[model samples]
Target: MKIKYLYIGALALLSACTANDEALLPAGAVELKGITASIDNGSGASTRAVPEVKDAIGRTAFANGDKIVFTKIERTENAINPFIYSNIPYEYDGKNWNRTTTDPEKIYWTDGTSFHTFIGYCLPSAITTWEPDDKGVYPAELGAGKDEIDFSSLSEGNNEMAKEDLLLYCNKSALAASDGVTTNVSLTHALSNVRVIVNIKNFAASAIATDTQTKVIDFKLLSQPTRYTWGGGSNTLSVVKYADNNKKDIKLWCPQPDGEGTAQSKTFTFYGLTTPQNETYHGINGNNQPLQFSFTVTYPDPMNPNGSPLVKTYQGAFDKTVNFNSGQCTTLNISLNHKDEQMFLGAEYSDWSFVATPDLGELRKKSTYMTNVDETAIVTSGQVDNIDDATWLYHVGKKVYDIYGNDGESAAAAYCITSSLQMLAFAKEVKNGNTFEERFVRLDADITMQSSATAEDYQWKGIGEGSNVFNGTFLGGDRYINRLNGSPLFVKLGSNACVEQLHITAVGNVTNGTLAGTNAGVIGGCKVIDDVTLSGTPAGALVGTNTGTIHASYYTGAGNLVGTNSDGDKTGTIVGCYQASDITSFTKEFLTNFIDGTDGENPTNGLNDDLNAFYSNESNSKKFRTKFNYTFTPGSYPTLKVVTE
Candidate 1:
C-alpha cells in the first residue's frame, strides 16, 4: 500500500564522469549529478525527475545526508576483471555526493584504449553490496543468498520498509582507461515491484445468515519459487529459492508507494525479484499458479450468532503465469469471498515503469541434475505435501484413488531418486494418473525392482497403464534402473514423455505403450531400449507395439526392440504410426544412421533433441560422456560407461 506519509520521496543519483589521461598516476574523476539533463538549479545540482516519466510513484530526489556506494574497476595491463576500488563511499549533501568513508580510492584512467567499469547503488542504510566478479558481475560468487542485500528485513511495515528501497546501476560503457574521463552512473531498480490487493466478499457464511460476522485472521502467500538468488551485471538468476514459509509477511521490498485498503481488503507488496525469460512457473509448490496465497477468516457460528466465531481457511491457486520484467512496478489484484473462492485479476502496471522482465530460476521439475538438490523438499513429496487435498497424493491402501500416492517427493520437481522404494513411490503416482507432464524424474543411483518373481512380493508394475500414463520426462544422468520386474518399465508412455541413457536388465520389456491412445510408440520425443527380458506376453526388447516416431536409437539384447503390433487391442487403437529406425533387424542404412566414432559424428545423427541413443564419442574413439551425462562406445554393441557433464 502506498501511503503518502511513507512513500513521499525516493533518492536516486544521476551521475556522470569524464576522464583525462595523466602522465604520472593516471588518475581521473567520475562525478555524479541528478537524473535530469544537467539542469543545474542555480545551486550547481540537477533535478532528479526524468521529464518523460510523469505521475511517478514516488519522488526521485535525494533528501540530503543520503548514502550511495560506488565501485570502480580499472583495466590496466588487463589486471583485475572488475577491481581496484570497492564501495567508493559518497554521501548526498542535498545537492552533491560527498565522501563518507575516509580515503576511498579515486578513479584512474589507464589509457585511451584501456577501460574502467563503474558499479553503484543507493540507500546504503537499507542495503549492502559486494565486489564484482571477473565477468563484471558483483560478488564474484553469486546464488549464495541475500547476505549483501538481505530481503528478510523487508518484513517491517511499509513506512519503515520504504527507506530500504534498492536502486542499482552499472555503467554499460566504461571510462577510457589511464585517463580522467567523466562517466555517468544512473541508479535504477534492477528488481520489479509488485503490489498485491486482496478483496473479501461473499462468504461461505451464508449458513449463518445476516448474523455472520466475517473477519480476517491470517494470510500468507502460496507460490512456488517466488524468490531465488539475485545476480548483478550480465549474469541473470539461474538458481531457485522456494517461497514455502507459512508466515512470510507481505511488505514492499523495493522502492514503491503503498495504499491502505478497507477492512475487507488488505494491501502489501513484494520486490527484489525478476522473472526468467521464456519460462513458466512449474515448481512443486504451485504449478503455473500466480499471485496465490492461503488465507484464514472467521464468521459467527451458524448455531448461535453469539457463539465463538467459526474459523475457516482458504487456499489460492490460479492458472496464471508470472513473467514480470526487470525495473518496473506491477500490481496484482486478488478477490476473496464468503464462498471461500479466490479470483486473480492479472497484473496492472503502475505509474513507475521501465522494461519490466521478470527473471527467476527454473521452477519446472523437468529433467533434474543429480547434485545440489534441495534435500528438504525431497522428503515431503514437495509442495503437495502441504495441500490438504486427499486427491492430491495418497497411498494405495490409505487413499489409492488420489491423483497419486506419495512416498517421497521433497523437491519432487528436480529431486533425484536413490533407492528402489523411491522409484516405486513415483511410479505409484504415475499409476494413479498423475500425468506429471513436464516434470522430470532422474535416478541418482541404480534402482533394483522386485528381485524374485513371487506373488507375495509386490511386483513392480510398469510406471503407467491404459488408464494412467507416464507423461513426464526422465533423465538417467549416468545412473541405472536394473532388475526391473514390470512387464515394461514404462506402460503407455505419454506423447510428450521421453527417456534415455538408463541401463536396465529385466526379464521382460524395457518400455511399452502407445502415446495418448492415437497409435503412439517409439515417438519423436522418446528414446532408448536397453537390456531386456525374453519372457513377456508379446515379448520384445523395448515396446510391445510401434506406432509413433523413433529416431537414431538402438538396442543390443536379443529380440526386436519393438513387437509387430498394429491393432489397438492391447490398449491403444493403432493409429497412424512410423518408426524411423526399427530394430527387429539392423542394416547398413540402419548402421549408416550412426557413423563410426572414427569420423566423429553428432550423437543425435541429424535428429533433434529427442533423439539420443547408441551414443559414441567421435573425438576420443573410446567411449566418453557427453554433457548429457552419457558415455558409450561407438561400435556394434555399446556398453554404457559412467557419464558426466
Candidate 2:
C-alpha cells in the first residue's frame, strides 16, 4: 500500500548579478545574485528506505529535456492574481553565472522589488487576466471546478501527453546590502509532479519482456482540472485543475525498468501538475459518485498486435482526489497482480497475460426485498453463470433444499435463498433452468416473518425465519444476510460470493456465522455491524468487490468493523475494490467513530488500517465530503440522498 508523498524544502539564494561597473548604478539598485535550489529526493537517493520517496535535483537537471522559467512579481489590481514581470534567462553554473539577456542592466533591479519565477511549460504566450468571483475564486473552465493551467498543449502527436519541468519562486524579497547587495530567496515548485510506476506482481523479468511482451502504453489520466491562478505572486498559489470531461493522455509509452528488490516495478514521471485550493474536489459523475482520474494502460497483443489493444484501467480505492503541495513529488504505483490466464481477457493470445476478468462490469445489482422483480436489477440472470450443480441438491426428488435437505441452513455451509417465491421464479427463468443465480445476487428480503415461536407477531421483516432458518442447506454460494433497518442480522456465504448495494439502519449485531466469501459490499445506509468476524476481504459501508460503481452509501455505528485476510492482513476496503468510479464518503466523524473496539468490546474494533486501505490501496474509489459539494447528510451515522435542490 504505497501513498503519495509531498516533499518540501528551501534553497538559499546567492547574489551574483552585478550592473556594468562602468555605469553608475541607480540610487537604490541592487546587484543580482545566483539562485541555489535542490530537489528533495523523497526516498534515499543512494539507498532505499522502508517507504521510499522520489529524489529531487537542480533546475538544470531535467532528465526529460525541460527548462525553467524566470520572472519577477509586481502588485496588480486583481486581488487574487499575481503580476508577472521582467522575464529573463539566467543560469547558475554551480558557483558562477550566465545571463542570456543582452543588457546586464536590464536584469538588475531595485531593492524594494520582488522576484517571481516559474517554468514556461504550457504557459500561454499572453494570458487573459480576469477578476476573482464574489468568493475570490477566479473562473474555472466550463466543466472544471477551478481554472486549471492547460498543459495539454505539450502533447507530442498521436501517442503523447503533457510533461514538463517547472519551479516557482514568488515575491522573494530583495534588499541592497550597505557594502554588496545580496537577496535571500527560496524557490519552490510551481507545479506538482506525479510519478506513475508500473509493477507486475508474481511476474518474472522474462515474462514481462518476452513471454507477455508486456508494454504499458496509452497511459492517460482522466477528469483532471485544467485552469489555475498563481496566488497573486505569493509564495504559494491555491490552484484548482478543473475536471476534464474526457480522458487525456499525460504519458505515452511509459518506460518499464526492471523492478528492483521484492515488488519489481517500472517508473514514469509526470511534471507540472496543479493542485486545487480544495484538495477534495472530486467531480460528481452521473451516478453522483466522485469522478476519478483514470490511469488507462494498454499493451500490444502478442497474437494480434494490430487488433484492439489489451487494456486495463487502474483506479485507486480511496483517495480519488489528487493532493499535492508546493515542491511535492507524489508517486502513483500501479501493479498488475498476476492471476490465472483464464481470468484475463487477452489470455487467448498469450499464456503470460495479466488482466482482471469481468466480474460485474459496471453493473450494480440491488434489491429491497420489497419487490419480487426489480427492473433496475443490474445483476441479470445472464451474469449469473457457473452454477455449482453439486450444491443444488435434490430434496425428496425435488430440487428445493441443500445437500442436508433443509431450509435456512447456515449461510457458511451453503447459499441460502431468502425468498422462496423469488427463488422458484428465478430458478425457472435461470437462462435454461440449470441452476440458481447465487454468486452475484444478494438475498436480503424485506418480508415480514416471526422472530421466534414465543413471540406474538412477526417482528423481524427480512431474510431468515424462526427456528428452522439456519437448518436448510444453501446452494450456489451467494452472500446472504438476514437484516432489518437496525436489528441484528445473520450472514453466510461460500468462497466466491460478493455482497453489494444493500442498506441496513439501526444498531444491529451482524454475525458472520460462516466465513466463505472473498468479498462483501455495504451499499446504501448501514450501521457498522456490532460483532463481525470473518476471514475473507470485508469491504466497508460501500462495497466489497465492486466491478461497476458504488455511490451514495455509508455506515454509522458505535461498533467496530473488523476482519482480515487468511494471512492476518486486513484487506477491508471502503469502496472500488476492483473497478472504477466507485465513490465513498468520509468525514472527521467517520474516521473518529469507527475505531477498533477498545475494551472487551467489539473484537474487530480499534483497527485503524481502514484509512490506509481505503485511501492508499489500489482500488479506484474516490473519497469525498459534503464540503466538496458531494450531496450527502452529516451526522454520527450520516446518510446520502439525492440533492434535488
Candidate 3:
C-alpha cells in the first residue's frame, strides 16, 4: 500500500477578480509558509513528527473580543501506505459542513480511486498530509475534522488571538501519517492569529483635580491712642477717654474666624471719668474669616481735685516775752492767720493768755498785816510806834489802836481807862517815877533788896557797913546784884528793855566763868546753893550732860562738867544726873556696889562722864534728847499711849 499526502506550494492565487482591481481571496484561509508538523506517539513520550514555524505570534497586540476555529483530519490504517479520513463533521454554528457561514468552499476530500468535493467551499489554502490506520481499512484524513480541530483556537482570532492561545499550539502538527497494526494518524487546524482594538474614547478622565481656598480678615486702627492718669504720677496708654473724676470698666470684642476669638484685650484705668470712649479692638481669624468687633470704655469719677481747703490756726502769744503780771485787765494778743479765722469761736478762746496781780493792800503798806484788808490805814490805826517800846494790845474790829496818848497805865489798864482827864492826871504822876524798877517794886509791894537806896541816888548807901552789913550773906543773889550794879543804875522808862524770853547758846571751850550765877542761879533747873564749877563734869550751866527736859528756864553761859569718882562711877561736876527719874550715883562706894556684877545693881561704874559732857555742851542737845526718848520711852513710861490710826 502507498501513503497519501496533501501538499500546497506557496503561490499567490486569486479565486475571483473584480474590475476595481481588488483580488477576492478565500475568506476562511490563511497562508502558511515554512510550516512543519510533528505528531506524538500514543505514549506521549516521543514525537513521531515535529512541526517548525519560523515566525511566532507576538503578545503585545492581543486583547479580548476575538474568535478562533480549527479544522482537523485523522489517519486510521496500517499498510505500505496510509489513508486519512475524518469521522466527525467539523462544527460551525452547530452544523456539519458549515463552511457556507464563515469559510465557504474551504473543504476537500480524496479516495483511492477518486476525489470528492463540496461546491460551496474547498480545502483551506494551507494543506497538510494524513496517513492511514495500521489495518489499512480507513483512508488518510485531512482538513480540520471534529476530533482534530480545536474550536477554542479558531474563536480567538475572530477578533484577535490571545498570547496564551497561540502558546497552546505553537509547534503542534496539523497533519498525521500512520502505518498498519495499531498506529493512528490525525491532522489539526488552529486559528492562532489574533487582532486587538482598545476603545479609549469611551473612558472619561479621572475625577478632575480639586483644591480649597480659605478667606482671612484683619483689622486696622480706628483711632489714635490716648493717655490716662490713674493715681499719683502714674499714667497708662488708654484707648478710651476718661475725665479727671470718673472710673468705669472698659471692654472690647473683636470678630475673628468662626472659631477664633480675640487675640488680646487691653484694660484702662481713669481717675475721675464716669464713662469710657475711643477704644480700639484687635483679634485674629483662625478660620480665615473677616473680623468685626466693638469696644465699651467706662470712666468713673471717684475723687474730686477741688474738694476742701486745708487750713491751719495758731493761738496764744507767739512773741517770746509775755508781760504776765499786767493784772486781770491785761489781754493776750494771739497771732492769727487767714486759716485761723475760719476756726470756731469756742476753739479760739481755749488758747487765751492768763494774767497775774499782786495784793494791792500789801503793795501800798509795804508790809504784811495779820488782818485781812485792802487798805493800809485799817492796819495802821492801833499799830504800836515801835514793837520793842510798846506791847501789842488786842485788836478791835479792824483797828489796832496803840496805848500812846496820856495814861501811864499798864498795857491792860490803858485799854480799860476811858476818861481822858483822869488818864492824863494819872500819866503825870506816873511820869515822876516812871522807872521799870520803881514800877516793879510798887507792884510787888516789898522793899526786898540786897541794899536799900533812894530814888535819886546812884549808890546803895552802906552796902558793906552800917545797918546793911555785907556779911557774905548771899543766896543766889550775886547774879542779880552784879547785873544791876553797872555804872548807870537808872534805866529810862518807856525805853526798849532787854526783856525777851532769853536764850544763851554756847558751844566748845565754854567755861563756868563765862557765865556766872548769883544766889538765884540754877544749873538746868537745880537751884544753886554753892559755887558750882562745870569743869570735868557731865553738866552744863545751860543743860545737864544727860539728855532730858528743862521747862520755863534761863541759862548762863557755862561749859560742860564731867567727873569720875575713885570707884570709877562717873558724874557731871555741877549736877548729879537722872534718867527718867532713876538716880545715877557719883559716889565711890555706890559705884563699886554697882560694879559687883550683880543683877539687881545699876551698871554706873564704867559710865563715861567726859563724853556725856562734850555731847551735852557742844553737840546738838535737842538731838540727844530725841534719841534718848526714842530708845527708852517703852521702859520709862508704863502708861504711855502711842496713838495711830
Candidate 4:
C-alpha cells in the first residue's frame, strides 16, 4: 500500500511565504467539513467519529487520492496524552495555530513503511501485551469509516489557489462529476471554508454557564446624495449639495430581532442630512443609555449662489438618555434664527412701579375760584398790573380803621388828600354837600402858649375892667371855660381868634373862688390855643383853680393866664392852682440845670432875681414867662418825661 500525509505543513508554509499585499479571498472560498477518526492498540482501542462535523471527510486529507493509514505491531506502557482539544475550531489553512515545537521528541514523521513516533516504541511483531500511545492507539486513526474524511483540495504551487480554494485535487480522476456537479478531493479545506465552530465537552458541574455581551459605537458622516430616508411613510430622501464633491455622505441603521428565527420587524430609524452628522452611544445596555446626535447646518446665501456669499451656519451637539422600562425620553435643543414679527405691550399705569405726573387737563377741571379762596375772601385772582401800588393802598386803609369807630387822623391822611388845595386838585366829587372848608380844614393844630404878652398881641380882647384890663372882657383869663367848673362866660372868643398875653393876679384873700374850674378855667384841659401866666400867692398859670380835669396841654413862647395871689395861699407857673389833681411835668437836662435853684424852702434870691430880670427884659414877658413855665414845668409837681436830652 502507498502511504501519504495530509500535508498540513504545506498550508502553514504557504501562508508564511505570501506577501502582505495579497488580497483576501472571497467569502465562498472558505468551507467547513466534519470528520471522524479512530485510534487502535494491540490490546484494545477506542474509536468514535467527531460530532457535528460537516462533509465528514469529504473535504479533508483522507479524501480522493490522498489517504492516511497506520498500524502498531506492539503496545507500549507508561505513556501520556499529547493532544489538546479546544472549544473553538482551529483555522488550520490560515496558519492561525503555532507550529513551532518545544520538544523534538513530541514531533513525529513517516516515509511510508518506516514511522517516526514521539510517545511509544513499536515492535516488529504483533504482541498481545501492547499498550496505546498518549493520544490512544498507535498511528492514531482519526476516522471511523473510509468515507468519514475531510480534504483540502488545493492546486500545487499555486499560492492564489491555496487562498481561493477549499479543496485540493491531485489528478483529474480524483475529481468526479456527478450529473452536472463537480467534486474535489483534498486532505483539508482552506481556512476560509471553515465556519466558526464551538464545542462544549463538559459543562461546569457546580454552576450553570451563561454569556452576556454589549458593544457601543460612535457613527459620523458627511452629506451624501444617494442616502435613503425611511419612516414617515413615503417621504423621499432629501438631497442637497454639501461642501464639495470631496466629501461623501454616509448613513447607518440597525435591525433588531424580535426573537430567534423571527424576521426583524423594525429597522432602526436613522437620518443623514445634507450636513455632517455625528452620533455617540454610551452605556452597557440600551436602558438609560445616552445617545448624542450632532449636525452642522449651512444656509444658502440669499444674495449670491455661485460666488462667495453671506451664510448663516449652526453647529452644535445634544445628548439624551432613554429609559427602556418607563419609556421616558429627553432631548437637548440649541437653535439660532431671526424672528422679527413679534409685538409686545408696555406695562400699564396701575402696574407701573414709579410715580408720574397726572394729566394737566384733569387737574384743571377740578380747580375753581370758590375752592381756592381764603376765609378773608382773598383770592389769588390773577397777576395785577401794579402790585406795589395796590399793596400801598391796602396797608393805608387798614391803618386808618381801628376796630372801634375812634378817629385816626395820621393814618387816614395817608390814604387821602388833606388840604383844600390838594382836595381840589384830585377830588372829582364830594359827598353830603360838604364844603372844602368842612372836609379839608386844619383838623387840629398843635400850639404852645405863653403868658407875658397882652391879649391884643394874640388878637384876643380881655374881659372885665381895671386890673383885669378890658380889651374884651371875659370871665376866665386865657383858658376855655370848658376846662373849669360849670360856669358860663360872658364874653366868647371868636372861632378863629388867636390868644397871646394873658395873666391873672390875686385880689385880696380870695379863698372860695376857683380858677380854671371844670366849666370856667382860663385854659381848657380839652382844647387850648394860648399860654397863660400867673403870679403872687395862690397863682396858677394854667387855671385859677382846677376843679374838674385838664389833659394834653403844652406851652411854648406863650401868653396866657388865670388866677391871682390871694393872701399868699398857692401858686404855679403852668397852672395857677391845682386842687386835688394829678399833673405831669417834663424838662430837658439842659433846661433843668439852668433852673436848678428854682426849687427850695425859700427860692434863691439870685436865681429868682435872674429869672425876673430875664422875663422883664423880654418884650413879650407875659408870653415868655408862661411859655417857659409850660415847656419846663417847675419841680414842684410829679413828672414823667421821654426826652433825648
Candidate 5:
C-alpha cells in the first residue's frame, strides 16, 4: 500500500498529470516501490503462514491500515548502528509508495542505472508511536543497557505515532530496491508464547478443613509486555523498563472450569514474551525480576454465615530461568495445596480484667466511708509518748486503745511497732494502756516475726497480749491471736507483712493501714474459700475467691493458674473483686480500687467487669475465653500455657 503525501498549490500542480503528459516524480524524489512481509520460522519451533495479499474473497490480507517503513541505515565500520526510519503511510487506492512531504530530508533519490538502493522496508511496524517533534528515528536493536526508546524523531517530526495493533513480525533480512525496482519482503512474529497451568488436588476436601469453603476466583501473570519490536532489523525482542509499582497483566485465556473428577486443572496462555535465555529475574518487576503469579480465593466462613467473605490471596514465583523463545510455548505447572497457617496476636487469661474500676456491688451501694468524717475519727486522744516510760491510752465512741513497743530493735521489730502505731493513729483512739478494756485493742505488728525462733520474745505479740488480759469483762486474748470480742479489729500491714492464710472463722472489717485517702486499704492477704484443685474440696487459696477483694498482692507460696478460676472470676497481678457470700459482706465501705492507687500510671480505661469476663452473654458470670493455647485437666480449669510473649 502507498500513500501520497497531502500537498497543495504549486507542489500539487507539479505532480498532477495532464492529458499531454503523465505524472512524474519531483527532481530529487524516490518512489517507495512495493512492500512485503516474511515470517521467521527458523527462529523458533512454531511456524506462521505469510499474510496473503488477498484472501479468498479478494479482500487484502493486510492493506490500508498496515504500515510500511523506510529507514536510512547509518552504517559505521566499528560501532553498532540503530535504524533511523521515517513513516510513509499507506493509502488504500495508491498501489505504489511516494513522498508527500516537501521537506528536503523527507525525500530520497535513486541513481537511474542502479537506483541508489534504499537500506530496507518494514511492514506492520511496531514503532507506531513517536513524539510529534521526532523525525521518525527508531533504535534498530535494543541492548541490555538501553533503558528507554524514543521513536518520534529521525529528522524532527512533532507528531507522535503509536503501533496500536499487536506486533505480527519484523522482517529478519533488510530489503532494498535497485533502479527504482521493488521486491517482496516477509516479516516474522516478534513475540514468544508462554502457558501457565494450575492443578488442584482433592478439590472436594481441602488440606485445612476450616478452609473448605475456599475457591479460586481470579489469577494474574504480572510483569510481561504485550508487544515486542517495532522497526524491522535483526529479529531482536523488544525490551521494556521494569517499574516497581507498575506491571502489565497478561491476558487470561481461561478461568477455573468446573472439575469433572477429584483433581482439576486450568490453563492460561500469554504472548509477547522474551526468548529463553536462562536468566533469572529478581523482584516481580525489576531487572531479572522473575514473573510472579498471584491468585485470589474467596473463603466462605462456615462459622460466621453473616460475616463478610474472607478474601485470601496467594502468590508464587515463576521460574526466571525458564525462557520464552520466539514461538516457543513454555508451560509452567503449579500445584495447589493447603496454604500456610497464619498466626495472630493472642491474650492468655480469660476475663483478663484490663483496667481497675469500682466493683458493681461497690458502685451499687454508692457507699464511701473512708472519707466520712463522723464515721471514722479524725484524731486520736493523744500522741504516743515514751513507749517504755509512761503508758498512753485514749477512748473513741465505742473503742479502746493502747500504746506498745517492740522487744527488739531489729528492722522487722521496728516495722511492726511503727505500723501498729500508724494503724492506731489512723483509728484515732490510742490509749495509755489496755485499761477499762470494754473494747480491747492490741497491736499484732510482729505477726510476720512469729515464724522466727525468738518470735515469742517479740514484745506486743498480737492484740490483747500480756497479763493485763481481760480480768473479768475485759476482752479476750490468746497468746498470738487477736480477741476483739465483738469490737472491730483494725490490722495494718508493713514490709514483709505475712498473713497466717487461715480460713476466716469469724466475720470482721478490713481496711487500709491509714486514713490518708480512699481505697487506702493495706496490701496484704485475707481468707475466702472457693473451688481449688489441690484440696479435695473447695478450699485452697487458688480454688477461687469466695468473697472480698484480692488486689495489688502476690502470693509467694502458691496460687491458682489463670484458667483455674472456673467460676469465671478475675485473677492476675492486678486488682480484682468477687461478689460476697450471704455469710459476710465487705462492710467497711471497701475500696477494691487498688488500680486507682497508681493514678494514671496504667493506660487501661478501667477494670474488666467480672460479669463480662466470660465470652458468654450471661450476666454476673465470668465466661470470656481466649483463643490462646491452654492446658485443661480433668477437674482443673484451663491454664494458659504461655501468658507473656
Candidate 6:
C-alpha cells in the first residue's frame, strides 16, 4: 500500500516516479511503485507515513524517515487465512515502498487466483504477526511507553510527535497484477487520546511529612478492554477483552515471556500520579459507555500517626455513553480536598477537548461511604442532600446560632460527621435548642479537635452546652475523637440519650491538676455511656458526677475515671468497667459510700491486649449483664474487653 505526500507535493517523488516509468515496461506484470502514504488533516494526532506528508493534522513532516510495516494476506472466495503474511518492512524514499528483502511472497496477477489484500502501518511500534480472531478482527498493541504522543513541537513542519503517532492504512480493494499501476493507501489515526489531571488541595499541616511516605497498592481500570481490535471484515477499530474486576477473565494469546515462565501480556501501561497531567491512549468508542478507573493511594491517617494507612479509591460510570472518533481526546479533571476527604470531578469534551466527568455523587469520597446527606435534593435540595459525606458542618453553622436545618432531630434522618468542622456544627446545633431526640448522628472518620491547650484555662466548650443537651444517640462507629481537653466531651446528656463505641484520646493537658470546673471529668455529665475508652497520659478526669449508668467502659488515664455527684447522692451504676490502677481507682470513687471514706476492696486490675484496663471481653461485658439488668445485643463484639488480675 502507498500514499502520496499530501502536503509537500513531494515534487521529488513525482520526478522519481517519472524516472521509474521511463523503464518499467514489464509485460503482464504490475511493478508496484510510487507507494507512499497520507493521513487525514482533521483534529487529532499527526501522521508520519510518508516523508514530508504534513497533512498529519498539519503538524508533521515525517522527519524520522518514511518506514512502513506492510502486511499481505491471500484472499480466496471462502475462508481467509488468518495468518498468511505479516510485518513486511518497506522503506519509502519519496518514491516507492521498496521491500527491505527482495523475493518475498508475491501474489501473481493470474485471474484464477483471488488477489491478496495489502495493509500497512507506520513505523515506531513493534510489528506483530497477522493473527485474526474468530471474528476476523486483527488486534493492535501500542505496547508500553506508547501511552501518549507529545505534540508540543512546532518548528514549521518538523513535529517530534510524528515518531509516536500510529497510523494504519488499508488498500481500497484487492488488485490483480497487470501493467504498472499505482495504488493509494490513506492512513488514519488508530488510537484515541485521553488526558487526566488531578489537583490536590487543603491537606493537613503534617500531611506533607506523612503523605510523602505513602505507597500505592493496586491500580486498575474496571471493564476496560485490554486488547484493541480492528478489521473484523471492516476497517473499524474497536476494543475487546471486557474483563473482570482483576482484569483476568479474557486472556489473549500474547506469548511474550514474563521472565517467570509466564506471559507478561495482561494489561497496558499503568501510570502513576507523580506529575500533574497524564495522557493515555484508547481504541474503544461509543455512547453511554461504562468505565470504572481506580488506584489505591495510601496516605497517613491524620488521627493515627502509627495506625493504618488511609486509602482512596476512584470509581465509575462517567456517563451513559460517550461518542468519539479515533483521533479525539478526552480529558478528566479531578480535584481532591484531603482535609475534607472530598473528590470533585469535572470534564470537557470536544474536538479539541475531552468528555469525561466523574459524576453520580456530590463531592464525596466513595471509598468509605463516608458522606451521605439525605434530604431534599441529593445535591441542591436544602431540604436534604448534605455536604456529600458527614461533610464540614463547622462551616455549615455558627456557635449556638445555626440550627443547620435541625427542626428537631426527627427519627427519619441521621446526619454524617466526617470532620471536626461538622462535629462542631452538631454540637452547636444541640446548644441551639435542637435536642437530637429520636434522631441519630454517625461518625464517619476519626476526628481530631484543635485548640490552644496552652491557655491558662483552655477548655473545650464540649458538645452539649447551656440548658441544651444531647438527647439523641451518638454512634461513634468504632472511631476516635482525639485531643480531648480539661472540659468533658459532652457537657450534659439527657436521660434516654446514649454514647457508645466511642474512643476519647487526650493528648495534651486534659487536666493539669484538680479536674477543671463544676462536676467535670472526661465527660461532664451523662446518662448512658457504654463501650467508651479513654487513653493517653494526662488524660481528662472522666465522667464527673455520673449519677447515670456507666457500662462496660475503660478509662486508662492517670486521673479520676468517674466522680460522684457532689450535690446529689453519690450514686451511679458502674458495671463491667475498669480504670487505671495507677490512679485513684474508679471502684473506690463511689465505693458504695466508703465507710472510712477511703477503705475499699483492692483496685481491680482489668488487663487486655490494647489498654490493659477494660470492659470489652465477653466475660466483662456479659458477666454483668444479669447483675446490672444489661444484656449484649447477641452477636455484637464488645467494644472494650477487660481481664482483672
| Best model per TM-score | 1
TM, every model: 0.34, 0.32, 0.14, 0.13, 0.30, 0.31
Model 6, range 485-509, lDDT digits (tens) per residue?
A: 4445676766656665566655344
Over 522-585, each residue of candidate 5 has an lDDT whose tens digit, in order, gives 1212222222223222222222222222221222122331112222352322233222122122
lDDT of 2 by residue, 349-395 (tens): 11111111111111112222111122212122322222222222222
**lDDT string, candidate 4, 1-645, tens digits:** 000111111111112111232344332221111112211111121111111212221122221222221121111111322222211111223222221223211111111222112111111111113233454422211111222122222134322211212221112122112221112222222111111001111111111111001111112222222111111111111212212222332222111111111011111112111221112122322332232232222222444534543323222222343211100111122222223312121110111000111111111111111111122121111233322111111112323211122222422332232211111211111111211221111111111112222333121111211122111111122322211111111121222211232222221222222233211222222222223323333333334443222222322213322333222443223322112111223345433433343455565322223334444555523322132222345533312221110
Clashes of each: 64, 44, 93, 92, 59, 28
Error of 6 at 261 (Å): 45
lDDT winner between candidates 2 and 6: 6
Mark the regions of model 2 whose C-alpha exceeds 4 Å error after superposition.
1-163, 171-179, 184-186, 202-215, 235-237, 242-247, 257-278, 284-320, 338-645
Q: Local distance difference test, per candidate?
A: 0.41, 0.32, 0.20, 0.21, 0.29, 0.41
What's the TM for model 4? Answer: 0.13
Top-down TM-score ranking: 1, 2, 6, 5, 3, 4
Q: Candidate order by lDDT, highest to lowest?
A: 1, 6, 2, 5, 4, 3
> Model 3: residues >4 Å from true position, as ranges?
1-540, 543-645
Higher-scoring candidate on lDDT, 3 or 4: 4
Shift in Å, residue 292, candidate 3: 86
* lDDT of candidate 3 over 339-432, digit per residue (tens): 2232111101111111111111111111112222222232213343322222212234543343332121332322222221212222322333
C-alpha positional error of residue 292 in candidate 2 after TM-score superposition, expressed in Å: 3.9
Decide which is better by TM-score, 1 or 5: 1
Better of 2 and 5 by TM-score: 2
Error at 343, model 3, angstroms: 37
Ranking 2 against 3 by TM-score, winner: 2
